[model samples]
Target chain A: MSLTAANIAAKPKPAATEGNGCQRFNTMPGNGAQPKTNYCASCAAHDKALCSRLTGSDLAEFGSMSQHKTITAGQMLFSEYDDARYYYTVISGDVRLSRMLDDGRRQITGFKSTGDFIGLGTDGHFTADAEAINEVVVCQFTVPTLNQSLEEYSVVQGRLMEMMQEEVINLQNHMLLLGRKTPMEKIANFLVERAKKYSGVDLDGDAITEVDVKLPMSRTDVADFLGLTIETVSRTITKLRKNGVIALETAQHIVIKDIEELELIANGEA
Target chain B: MSLTAANIAAKPKPAATEGNGCQRFNTMPGNGAQPKTNYCASCAAHDKALCSRLTGSDLAEFGSMSQHKTITAGQMLFSEYDDARYYYTVISGDVRLSRMLDDGRRQITGFKSTGDFIGLGTDGHFTADAEAINEVVVCQFTVPTLNQSLEEYSVVQGRLMEMMQEEVINLQNHMLLLGRKTPMEKIANFLVERAKKYSGVDLDGDAITEVDVKLPMSRTDVADFLGLTIETVSRTITKLRKNGVIALETAQHIVIKDIEELELIANGEA
Candidate 1:
């Protein structure tokens, strides 16, 4: 097992206080000890997060229990079976969640980006290893503190349930992709999702001709996520580029030259 | 494309009163229109269901809004894109939930049995098709009524959250199986899960040597759920039988003679 400094701790401690040779911030304010800064008001993810349901004192109280923690690229936020004492909402960058077999074969379950909530559906322990695909910033909350907030704020509780419902629907869609989609369909679908998530190109909204997409994870991670070999993923992307559906900017970036064409392929209607 | 009598309607109406040529009951009691009997107290799935958190008048009031509907084998309870209306708790038999690709490829996302909630994470429309694997009975509730109960009872909401958490965890594990595990491993894992769910033979509990597992769904359903071909599923089962890990009592029944060995294969440890 590849152990990280974050997974070594058995108890729930503030990641900001752990001197793990990484960038960390004690951003919890309004707790009497720290200078009261209305952090939630200025946060980029505030409007999209579960805390958006709260206003004034409720938002401040919830934000006080939250600490800002930075995870370096390629470092683990937590491993499978770790004590799931904290919940996080991604502020920036990306995190990949995965689980492994006894023989060391890994399956990338899902990727979380900005405004995404993590650890909402966990029991007492984490079921997957959460690793930073890029330098990631997250607002962290202890389970007790979050649960208490849920008890006190029905709106927050309702919002959390809504988020979880969306998560379930996403997973169900992903399950179809993993189980049945062709390699080309899977790659196209992945790009379409990234375009929507990263560039706000809505499939059902106004038609957009082109969008630049950033893929922070490696080809191997992409292959794992799509349940295909890396060679298949690379060859399929090359096929798309040759077909003039997309243009490669780099190994980590691409420009979707024909979004509608890509969507047709994604839906297996091409 | 296969529309059942249940899916022909677009509005939220009680399935019991629809005269759909299926077994239906107006079991909702204590609403001043029906006889007052504590139906929940005698329900087989009550102790294990979300309503277990309620008692006395609370349970009675919530149960008053629930209707029991029976779907014959092979009939659809709902289909994809159907207007989301009723949520169900399986009282008996099995239901399969699946999604289909545009070209007619299908992927079975899950199988719901007794005490399993059918429609918790849906948005305003059902994302997948739900069909009965056998004659299935389920307690049904309208979405608005369920929402009202959730707002009135915190314990029910909490229990629903816990159930969704378990659903997420199960889906994650299945994703691993679908992505990384071999065909043998997938079949073994599926059987082990069935053994646990149908027979209650906890892997961590006792040293039970044998368990009879019922395969309610067809081999095609099993193949779709496991991301394998029907030929591969049958071949894997034959291999297991030849190795004495399991025995085919019939086409629809399996006797796990060596569960430990089966579990080892499921975990890719053998």
Candidate 2:
């Protein structure tokens, strides 16, 4: 039983030891109906982010600490070793978190999208570089301001802790993919995750046979994320298309024709 | 600029945005002198675990909820899909956390030792199997008991959140290693972490030249952990020994004679 991101993040429980049961990152809705500030009232991430925990005066105060920032495509939100002055919640678009070796070998650790948090680090320095794959909007919070909010609002603290736990689980599942999966399995797995995130389908029973999936990042990013060469990634995608599992609409868009078959390949069952 | 676990966990910064400055797992002394109960006074992980946040009455009450249990070598503390009824803090010995594919492909996600926490899962079920590498002693807390303690203690919540973030950073670093690093670099990086954890010497500035390191897990475990074949792992170790960078004392023991060179190789610099 290989641990895919879908299975790992989809498991639902009534309650967790630390917080509301294991929340899947970027997938949880706000806990309850809370009054939204004028500034955050129209924000897409407002309902899904830690800020969702605040309401009334608490919400206003926390919203005042945030600054909405836009990063252009191919621009870095933060680079490795930069002082982590700000943490972010993505409002829209995709961000790739990566680490590069001295010789220029790069590994994309994760891709951040709408409602995803970024800029976690150690020792006041970012652990990786987060670059925008497309023009991105993010809610930025200075370290001190966010820390103050965390202390003053138990709701924020609880939600943030739960998010961190979910992140750890996601990373652990990714580790299995990186270390153990074959190139075809890796490509299939990536497509499966894309279908889950962008397709807007419940995917509970795999009832939907066709789903349009977007690939915001380039093939190099996909290769780096999956621990494969770009050629291998291309060949594998072609192999899947030839097998009628998926069809490419364009360089950046794909149509998953048979998600069941794709899922089987993702888990190496095929 | 590779993000190794040592650097990710070792970066010391005062006054973190979170609880403390990215405290390393299995390191970090307790915050301050605190009154310890009779039960926790002699426990090895008492000062390093989440219980470190408790004192006097809080300590006693929390200590009462823990059951000190020993697991013999080759036994599983928990298995994949098992109900995560209890969480644990390792007081002694080692536990290997892993996931297995249906065809027997296993990926060792992490190895937990003294002060390491385990039983993190999704949907109230474990995502991986945690098995004892040796005779292991752990302090166990039922899920409900731990949740109650977490809600009652802000200090505990803060510390757990910090630990979870650190775990995320550690996993991110490991992802780079598994996805991009060469087999020799992987083995060297593994040894560098082993030296930092088991050698009981400050690795800063390359002060120490000779250090004895123990490999609690077998060759098969090492292969799985590093995403390599057993032959590759063995050949790499032999290469290191022949190069005079290290000496094999026994199957489970190693002596790092040239730690500086090992460090260079670990970072892919040598």
Candidate 3:
């Protein structure tokens, strides 16, 4: 379906707190009746955030400057050309960062999951749109506050730099995938990466054997991320399954039956 | 041509000093006849590197940690799977950063020009190979020395973080181009970006007219960088020229005749 501001506005709005140092704007009136507190110590991403580098009062100070936000699936957290007021860190679920051409062609730049940082553009305006692929929770802080915290905490600044470098590396690898990898190779690489990122190890005796990977994004999203059509993505998955390299547990789950073989295909050795 | 380690090692080596607080390894035997000193203050990228943020003793200390080297065209600066011991910043000319699959498919991730930083991978091993597209000069520094300098100078750390963020942004834009843009749109975007980056404005009676953009990399390199075939790249350039949107002064240089129209095509609005 085509995305428009008016259509997006008609969806369910996120519920946020309005008073006691936390102010939230509801996209739909009376939608945010269930108020929530913006506490960082109890946050899921607290350990992965820059605030984790802080100690005692410093952590409390950072918590006071941050807010917790929950956005529903298909809801846009922000759009292209919007003024970037707050930096974000994903706490749960998935967020798709994308840019759409005027003719409606969309490129998914990234699928940000737990612990991934967002909205750190150098320019005042965002160059891409960010939407929730599932129910997503994020920690938000103003740019000024983030900068002040960075100046006050060197470790925090160092961590932020490290994350940005990680982002550069991730994007570079994606470029290789989109520019060179064949359809099957792209699918293999995607599965391998997802398994490494979000898989649970299944131990057979003292040695680890397999992993269970959950894919939150749809096949269409995968096609967009891999720079292929939906038909190509589906065909490749069927071929891999036929080749006995992978097993489908459900629509949004996969089991890497032959990981070594998958790795060979991913590296283009097969 | 297929790139192999032996072929790359057979190219002309980069000249470097062997002793006197600097050690440089020659990639090929009997290839370096000229030796050079490690002088950061007199370097061309002095105002662009991380050392530019240093002052007085800090500047001198950073200078002691950096080495300047000139690499000839077609020579590999560093290859994939090599140890990423040093970070580099281009002082002059262009460098191509690319990765090749085991089956020989290669993708050019970026073309690093003057003031662009390279070799900032997080893992110990380099993920892509960097080669000098032309005779190029670069400033190199070890990671340990860079970290020590960061400890001594917060501004240097901040500046490094900013550059990394810029790299992330650049790669994200390229992701959109590779994944979504049509061939015409891709070429249009590439030209517009290059013009903005390297163009010199010619003013006719203060009215501000045409822009002169230099294309240092070859057509094949541009094709690989844009994820298109060489034939498609050449044909698109010819089409643009015939359409009166751009004029070719030489094979390696272009004048954006109608930048406004080019911008519209780049955004896919035309």
Candidate 4:
């Protein structure tokens, strides 16, 4: 591990949380577009917690606050502990969440896609960086309004709580990936979740099971997230493809061919 | 890294959402202590999003829900991917959150203390193991009610969201420790945070200015949590002590002699 002088003493705590690090989002600026009246109209996962109770102005505010911005691959959205200016919703495209060590090595913690919220925090601050994994679009909102709304709406609080609960578990999931599993196991876990999350179309809310999760991230990024080298990520993907369990359209597009076999691989049954 | 077939597929989805793997807990059964009023008048961390919102029947139901259990050192309270039967508020002692690889090596994730909640989940989970770093008292609640309450309260959601945000960042912080910061830097980060979180009495809204965070968890656990061997944790702490940056009252008790200096270490300043 490299210990730098910046590692010597902590920076003075900012007296007031500043808005300095807040920068241009990589999309259409401002909380511009209006979302469909019912974000959950076609999804079952919608009512689980977030946005479950709001259908009117409250929902509109939450929806309205989102300004979709498209970022080119390699552009940074925000950096760690930046003035917690905004929170984001993945409208489309994949974003990478990561932390950089003093020496410049990076560990990608997650690759977020549509519907995932990034930059959730307290004390009106951020603690890590968010970067676009590919050309990506995200809806951004200032936290002040959201914070105010949370105070006024118990329902919002409940949903946020559920999200937090989910987060704690998510970190634990990361722990499982970083602290426990190998590259193969980590890749399998990632693919399985993406499959479950992105699978199918909603046919009259019945949820059509047409699985197609295009990977917006590359091997190196995947390797970084899984705490493995890029070669390892490439080798594992190659192995999975060779096994006849999945069909790869590109490094980015994936078509899980045999759901059962994929599930087995995901379950370590293979 | 050990590559093995044992965990080709492990907890396929978020584990905490599952409802199995609890070691049934109950003690002093006859006390039949009436549940605390729904307001949770006696709970610590009042005003915290989780504690503040549980009022009257909610508080009563939330606390009454707690089945008391004692865990011995090294005994696991929960494991990754176990269905969460209960969300625990640490009543006494400390719990060490960690994950074990299939090969049996472990990484300490987070350390818990009195008033801290453990095994919280939302996607239907405990994603990591909560083990007793010291003999401990925990109040366990059923997941359904907590989920129900989460929907009913925004403060709760706010608190949970903050927590999830913290967990994600802490993991990110730890990744920094493992990937970038040196041993001394990691130890410094631990000291500064512990001092801030535990080492103070309740004064006004903020914790008292001069309180001590007694680490019930051991150096070994700290070493594991910081991604270093015990030798490193020991050597770093010893170095800190010799430099007058920290004072050791006992093996587990610490007092920061120089907070700013400690922060320097955390910030990677040399």
Candidate 5:
């Protein structure tokens, strides 16, 4: 059976346990404590997100139309075939976008983090399922509201187009990774890519032996994303650690000991 | 070692022969033909392409900015790392968008046909290489020209955004096919998808015993696109034919004898 939101809600909630290696958190309703004035203008992701192009009255207008939403780990933001009524901009945390076959085999298409936009579907229904990987806060806008605003703000429209173009590029890169890369290369590429997401870090800090990399998603999620088994994922990580390419700070954190080496491996040159 | 435009140009041009199972045609220079008025409005792809939304003066302006060119099968339309100067809309034939690793491993990300847009790059450089699968005709426009047109025509801008969103959806579907689907399922899905591309075909004609489907791309291109080896692709096609699901009219044409059976195989239910 398909894992719809209603199906998930109907099922008995699993215990909030860490033993299974799958992280879980309880869903909470909105607190309604957010600031009313110029929310988009003051957003932390404003400069980096599609909203950054908006200014003055346009930015304020977007803020008025947007609602802040928080989703706990394991809570689905939307499911396949869900009505495409909302557009989302990730404020914080990661959201895993996946699709499942009839037999329940899943493929994680993407992991959206800060400043990433979601729910830009052509058809009225979502083609994939999106679930919160951790505590995720997003600025949500109703489709009609966003489309009206886009009509008024050319800059906002341009930014949205640019964002979509970037999404296409990202998807193409991931396609290559999925279609051609080896398992070791996939892991290395994933790590390097995840590192790049955390911009402003000293990526070329040769003196620094290890740089801590946060991995909010579990190994299973990583495996699904990379089209590998969980055992393969674990084994590859362990092999990288043994080779001094990476170090495990925790189950959810990795330390890149050799960025150059990882790059070489990712490019299949090592 | 990279297959850059320079490398392609440096290599000796293959003879324009069809006997090799690949059609090679010479790249023709742009010619200022007759009937300059109402170019976009009178375009054959106007109803199908993004230009359909444009009207009157906007259409005329766009037509003035676009140049039509034909590229042979072996010609490179654009290469990875090339400057993103022009945007193209395929008027006829197919183009393969691909990326290659430094070690020469290639991944076919997409195959664009009639009315499909190309070169919507996020950065100033193209992320993938585009080559004509056969003799192809395309309408090309400079990036600045298209951006200027988009600013003037909101309909054009909206259409572009819609196209990008559709591209994201397509990429997600392909990701599932690459990462999750079995080899047989992949081939089945590919055939079904290719059949759908041919508009006006009797896709569901219960009375029709078989329907012809054209495949402009070679088996090797198909294998690369589906993440399978050529031998595996051949074997899978043979199996489908032996099962009475399809018949090969030629290496490039497939006749679907049982659409229901193909659908079942595509869904992994058969």
Candidate 6:
């Protein structure tokens, strides 16, 4: 959420205003792994963000400034009103975006898996808290560089706008899902959507066709996400397994052996 | 909600499979609001939408083919998979964006005030249902006009993208609000936000510096929106009034005596 002078070029005239474009943004290279300031560990050529339309030198230019950073679970990447510094792309593990109440009860607003973008609020201070769900690897870009890139390339800007809009739509749908959806419907939809995102079980090899996505958060977190209680999440998952709508390969892993059936269940067919 | 054919000349088209650079789309007006159209009452005007954004000669040209349609409270303006024939704009009243569970549980995704856009989903099929909260009026547009308008104006496209992104942010925030915030915080914040939207209130020709917003939804609907039980909502309101954070003039009218105190409460001040 913020970048420091250590991460960015030092300006002699660092005139008092917190760099709205780039302030206190820093990255933690994976422990004991050689750090490459040029390319992030998880965000190298293998990054899913590379799947975007940017190609050739444009992609390289992007990757160059997208420095590698790391965060452990519960570590605050940035909170509301931190100077806006860098935009992030998750490379490995999960990132949880959340907001808090004064009494300390916090609702995890969103979870960023690999390939998801983390921060993109407007010119104001950060709106939500971005925290890592687990040890996460990410690529951070300074605000000024990002703005220059966005202004220079219309395609990039358009794509960025579209992605932002898409994130918003996803968030809205999740609100409905959390606020009103039944437990079974929530679990079903989560499974299908996660399966779509996680893809390939890596069973025999990378070529494995099917997938079983693990629930990263516990029942409590899932409940928070779905606006239900932990008891409800447990009961519903149990019900799903019993009904053969989904299989519990382990406490964490959910084997969505049938996507179509999962979809049916999510649509309230069950 | 959409205008019905015979009663109106516009047709709604599905957003599914809609690709870019859409210059060839025909704006020819048709008749009637189809049951299948995703008529979001909120999305009344899009900078790129033809029927809603038309002006001067353009308005006159399109008006000849348009018709006025009214929907009664609690009736569906459109449902999922409705063939897109006409686009709609709410002339009056409010609508709810919702999806249902087969067993009858309902999730209200969003509420549309005047000038809000509705019915836009990926597949040209409405992802949810639109229901009138009261008597509602809509003007319809053919899909061709919408696509044509998008192709012609880049600025409009930019504005459309910005609006969509804002909607997304609202949803994401709502997810946090519903999933994490407590009952009192939810209602207080909801009221505060609505007051901001309505701006100021008039009382007996004297200006009320602080305004109280009447919640448009029933307790049951409010429960769904806040992810709480109706009892919780009722109890929370009582507690708030007792705390002197707010005063209830009637069952529907809420007068905020101290907005700063309300904000403090919303932020978890004791």
Best by lDDT: 1
Model 6 per-residue lDDT tens digits across residues B52-104: 44445544544444445667788777775566555555556778877666776
Q: Name every residue pair that clashes in candidate 1.
A: none
Model 3: residues with Cα > 4 Å off, grouped in runs: A1-43, A52-58, A202-210, B1-43, B46-48, B51-61, B202-209
- Model 3 residue B205 CA deviation in Å: 13
Q: Tens digits of per-residue lDDT for model 4 on B1-270?
A: 000112112346554333333333332433456454622565554444256555676665555555666777777777666665667777777888777655566777788877676755424345567788778777666776666655565445445554555555566666656544678887888877787677664323433333355777777788777767788889888998899878888878877776767777787765
| Candidate that scores best on TM-score | 1
Candidates 4 and 6 compared: the better one by DockQ is: 6
TM-score (all chains, Cα) for each model: 0.89, 0.85, 0.81, 0.68, 0.86, 0.68
Interface Cα RMSD of candidate 6:
8.0
Candidate 1 CA-lDDT value: 0.81
CA lDDT, candidate 2, residue A35: 48
Off by over 4 Å in 5: A1-38, A204-209, B1-42, B202-209
What is candidate 3's lDDT per residue for B5-49, written digit by digit as tens?
Answer: 111112222433222223342231342553222244555666766
Please give the DockQ score of every candidate, comma-separated: 0.40, 0.23, 0.32, 0.21, 0.31, 0.25
RMSD in angstroms, all models? 6.4, 11.5, 9.3, 9.1, 8.4, 10.0
Q: Comparing to the true complex, what docking class would candidate 1 get?
A: acceptable
Residue A247 C-alpha lDDT in model 5: 91
lDDT score of model 3?
A: 0.73
* Clash counts for the predictions, in order: 0, 0, 0, 40, 0, 34
lDDT of each: 0.81, 0.76, 0.73, 0.62, 0.76, 0.61
Name model 6 segments beyond 4 Å from true: A1-51, A57-65, A72-74, A120-123, A147-154, A182-185, A201-211, A216-220, A228-250, A254-267, B1-77, B83-92, B119-123, B135-155, B201-210, B229-250
Q: What is the lDDT of residue B263 in candidate 6?
A: 63
Error of 5 at A42 (Å): 3.5
True contacts kept of 4: 0.33
Better of 2 and 3 by TM-score: 2
lDDT of 2 by residue, B168-232 (tens): 76788899999999999999999999998778887775467888999999999999999998999
lDDT of 5 by residue, B1-270 (tens): 001121111212232211122221112223457334445565666776868777776677677777777788978887776666778898888999998888978889999988899976446667788999999888887777787777777667667766766778789889988988989999999988887677357676666546678888888899889988889999999999998899999988899887777888897788
Query: Model 5, DockQ value?
Result: 0.31
